[model samples]
Target: MTVSNNSLDVAVLEWCKLMADRNDKHHWSHVVTDAAAFEGSLLTAIGMTKDEFAGYETAMRRYRDKFIAHLDSDAEMDIPQLEQAERAVAFYHSHVVEQEAEGIDLHGLPATGAQMATYYHAEERSAAIRYDAAMQPVAG
Candidate 1:
């Protein structure tokens, strides 16, 4: 196989989109705060306070804005911890999706965004390996 690496990775951008703060971000907002729901935030279920998790959310937003959303070189910063981001996503699935997503039929699907990305990476890797093998020259 000639090609050393081949993979599509847009996880950070997608994760940032989910964690972003916007009026249209209904599900995320509902999980993060009680602004839209009469019940309190689901963040507590994950053993995190709004203030505690806000930093992670903010980091994702900044990463999205400065890097993925734009080429703002001056504002670019380090990505947030993957474990923190994945935890937030998992919490959303359990607290909101399992509780409120009636008739949505989320069964057989990965529970978190990180798990979904794993499938994408695996598929891309398989395709790349196949392509590399196919392109190998026949022995003279």
Candidate 2:
């Protein structure tokens, strides 16, 4: 796949994982839903205004609900989702930097969505390779 294709696949896969985890019986959805509920606080924490944060959230939600989860027939995948994902990833990175600056340790935090996506894509590629190898004719 081309670089763009690989990046898009990673974004779509990451979005799918987010949706699944968020909707599962476990309290994962709390991460996103709860954060959204405290939009004011989170915005302040992230150094973003409500409008800027809303733009990011809207991009992600539209991509998730319309393209990833529901697959709305009228909705077409767009660059906004990719842009928003990159922005969100950067937001998280800033938090990490801030924590480090404050002398706080982050040994147990979960990997960022972008990191998870890379790991998932690697696993997928490995599985495909194994499957293809298994399907090869035996050289008796």
Candidate 3:
């Protein structure tokens, strides 16, 4: 059955939100990961058969491309923001935790990292949960 692109888009965004919620408050990776999964689920909900979808080699590649494209396509950020983000992972050498920890009071640092990590990790987990719910045998 063909699905409405608008409806699918809404579903995709909703799943992305769910993913964001799952990821630790600070962990952004999970959001990306879940958004990918959300994309995959949208594909399936419209009926990509197990055999057809299974051919994708664990479905990891499917959403990964979309996620990267999404990052590349963000219109709000200018070169500077991209540069800062690049610096974050590259120059600043900030893992999600370190980025969140920078300049925070010591007492709050540990708690904040813990919270963010939990949030980000949760996003990944939520994806897995939904994947399982989708009844697709996950290869990895």
Candidate 4:
């Protein structure tokens, strides 16, 4: 249970980072030709329309900025309990996981929490590298 809870915390934080990064104009400007088009592609790939993605991103960013990113004195962030975290994971598995999977059998075998944590860490590291590469000034 502890492992699962820790895994959930890591997953949530990873997702928060993804949301925050995607919404950042600086990050988007570094990689894509048209930000809106790139965002639309991302939203479609994630099984959400532009408006839906906007609402979800807005909420996630609010929580991320208030709680995870800074220790804002006046920010009121509602941290989810373990039960809520479990429910969120279950919900994602049921609804969102399939959409994200591309030819991979996500439901075939469940990975342990430790495995997931490692995977998430690797993914974050790779994403950071990609972001840095995109931001580098191109030689003429």
Best by lDDT: 1
Tell me the spans in candidate 3 whose CA falls farther than 4 Å from its real position.
1-111, 137-140
Worst 10 residues of 3 by lDDT: 79-88
Each model's lDDT comes to: 0.59, 0.54, 0.39, 0.52
Q: How many clashing pairs per prediction, in order?
A: 0, 0, 10, 0
> Which lDDT value does model 1 have at 95?
55
lDDT string for model 3 (21-70, tens) is 24445334342334455445434453545455334322222233354225
Candidate 1, residues 36-72, lDDT tens digits: the string is: 4412444655566777767767876776677657868
Clashing pairs in 3: 22-122, 22-123, 23-119, 23-120, 23-123, 24-116, 24-118, 24-119, 24-120, 26-116
Residue 107, model 1: lDDT of 74
lDDT of 4 by residue, 1-140 (tens): 44444554575566554344655543433434555655555655566666865666566566556655676886466654333333334433333343434446554543444555567579768876876777789999
lDDT for model 4: 0.52
Clashes of 2: 0
- Measured by TM-score, how close is model 3 to the native structure? 0.23
Ranking by TM-score: 1, 2, 4, 3
Best by TM-score: 1
Tally clashes: model 1: 0
Candidate 4 — which pairs collide? none
